[model samples]
Target: IPHELYEAADVEGAGPFRKWLHITIPLLKPTTLYLMVIYTIAGFQIFERVYIMTAGGPINATTTIVQLIYQTGFSDFNYGRASAEALILFAIIASFSFVQFRFLSTDVEY
Candidate 1:
């Protein structure tokens, strides 16, 4: 799909921005939305990478919500707050997944 679009755009001398807006983006919406959800969940759970790379330092530049939960629960011994944060995260993920599934599962009748 992308290759065909790119070829057509190239033949028409379309610029990259025009090609993306007119061809690539429309064709890639489904894949992009799925990947966006996956990346958002991954970002929410970012811990080890930040720990190993930044130690959540530089005034918490790399501090993630998951890292904060771990620090609160284990380091500060605040299990209740950590649990609340976890529940919030779960609710966000569940809502996104439900919406994505509902939209993707619909038939696009031509």
Candidate 2:
């Protein structure tokens, strides 16, 4: 943060909450958005953790798309279903990216 901003805030008698709410949070908007997008993409592609923990047992409750693809392709030896599931996963990721870009891709001014 620039010293001038805090100095001005201090001069204006703004409290810590006020400075954080009005200045700090606004300044960090871009970083927040970037992290949100990155995490969203990563969250959708999760597989190993769920696989190791649950392995989609008992009813396939904890299965992820990637895990389903693995089971379909290798375990069941059904390449066609795995390919279709992969395509579906791609479509889902693409749609999410499109929406995020459409709404959150606006240029933020400092």
Candidate 3:
């Protein structure tokens, strides 16, 4: 943040929260959106934590796509289905990445 903006807001009697809300948040919107998209993609790939913690036990409630792929490929010995599932996951992530690029490209401001 630039000191001039805070000085200007201070001159206008805006409180800390007000300045944060009206100034800082807007400035950080692009970074926040980028991070949100990145994290969303990463979240979709979650498996190690769930596997290490629960092993998708008790009816496989905690299973993720990666885990599901591993089970399908290795445990069940169905490489085709696992490959299809992986393709589906890839398509989903690709779609989200496409949307992110399209949105950020068009909506960004200087």
Candidate 4:
């Protein structure tokens, strides 16, 4: 989308940076914000990378909230706390998604 906008701007004699600031960035805000949320959630739930590389070692340097829940539930045999934490995480994600959708949705103008 940004690339298309930039190409159109270029045909109109706009500079690259100007095209980005004037045409690309504004159009990309919603996409950028959505991607940011997705990437942040993915980072928060990161496990395989930590497990394969660090195993949450070095004093839990790579231990994310999801990994902590997993350790508590499976390794330490504590299901109740883990379930509570999981529900909290789900609620946070749901709320964020709802807010993002509400803010990013476009209303058709006749």
Candidate 5:
């Protein structure tokens, strides 16, 4: 965000709240969008932390999709099921990315 925009807002008697709401928030939309997409992808790919921490837990409570995929493909020798799970994971992540972009994307110009 440019200092000049805030200066103009001040000249127009915009209060701090107004400036933050109208200016700061709008300016941050692109950054927020990027972060949301990246974090969503990262979240869907979670495996190591859960595997190392619990290995799907004392009663299989902490299992993530990625860890399940690993167990299905390698441990159980169920490649077909693991492949299907991977495809489902891909579809889910794609749908989430699409929804996030559809809602949050804007023609932001800095």
Candidate 6:
């Protein structure tokens, strides 16, 4: 954000909260959208941390879809179910990514 915008807002009598809400947030939309999309994809792919940390945390409290797929395929030897689960996870991640890009990809001019 430009310093001049905040100065102009100050000249216009906009208080700190109003200036932040109206100016700062709007200007940061693109960055916010990018972070949201990236974090969402990262969240869906979480596995190693849980696997190495608590290994699904007592009673599977920390079990993620990817970890479940791993257990299903490697531990239980259920390749068919694991394959289906992997496909479903892929579809879910793809849909979420598509929706995020479609809805939040506005032409933001600073």
Please provide, for model 4 over 14-106, each residue's C-alpha lDDT reduced to its tens digit, 9 standing for 90 to 100: 987897787666677767777967975786677887788987889998787888889889998999999998999888877887777777655
User: In candidate 6, how many Å is residue 53 off?
Assistant: 2.5
Better model by TM-score, 3 or 4? 3
Error of 6 at 64 (Å): 1.5
In model 1, state the lDDT of residue 36.
73
TM-score to true structure, per model = 0.60, 0.77, 0.73, 0.65, 0.95, 0.77
Which segments of candidate 6 are over 4 A away from where they belong? none
Native-to-model Cα distance after best TM-score fit, residue 19 in candidate 2, in Å: 1.8
Q: Model-by-model lDDT, in order?
A: 0.80, 0.85, 0.87, 0.77, 0.96, 0.93
List model 6 lDDT by residue over 1-110, tens digit each. Answer: 99999999999999999999999988887888899889998999999998999999999999999999999999999999999999999999889989988887777676
> What range of 10 consecutive residues in model 4 has the weakest lDDT sum?
101-110
Model 3, stretches more than 4 Å misplaced? Answer: 12-18, 97-110
lDDT of 2 at 28: 74
User: Which is the better candidate, 2 or 3, if ranked by TM-score?
Assistant: 2
Per-residue lDDT for 8-100 in model 1, tens only?
Answer: 789999999998787766666677778877887887787898898987889998788888888889999999999999999899888987887
- Candidate 1, pairs of clashing residues: none
The numbered model that scores best in lDDT is 5
Query: Model 5 segments beyond 4 Å from truth?
Result: none
Clashing pairs in 4: none
Model 3 gets an lDDT of: 0.87
Error of 1 at 37 (Å): 4.1
Tens-place lDDT per residue, model 2, 27-105, is 7767777887788889989998899988996798888889989999999999999999999988998888777777766
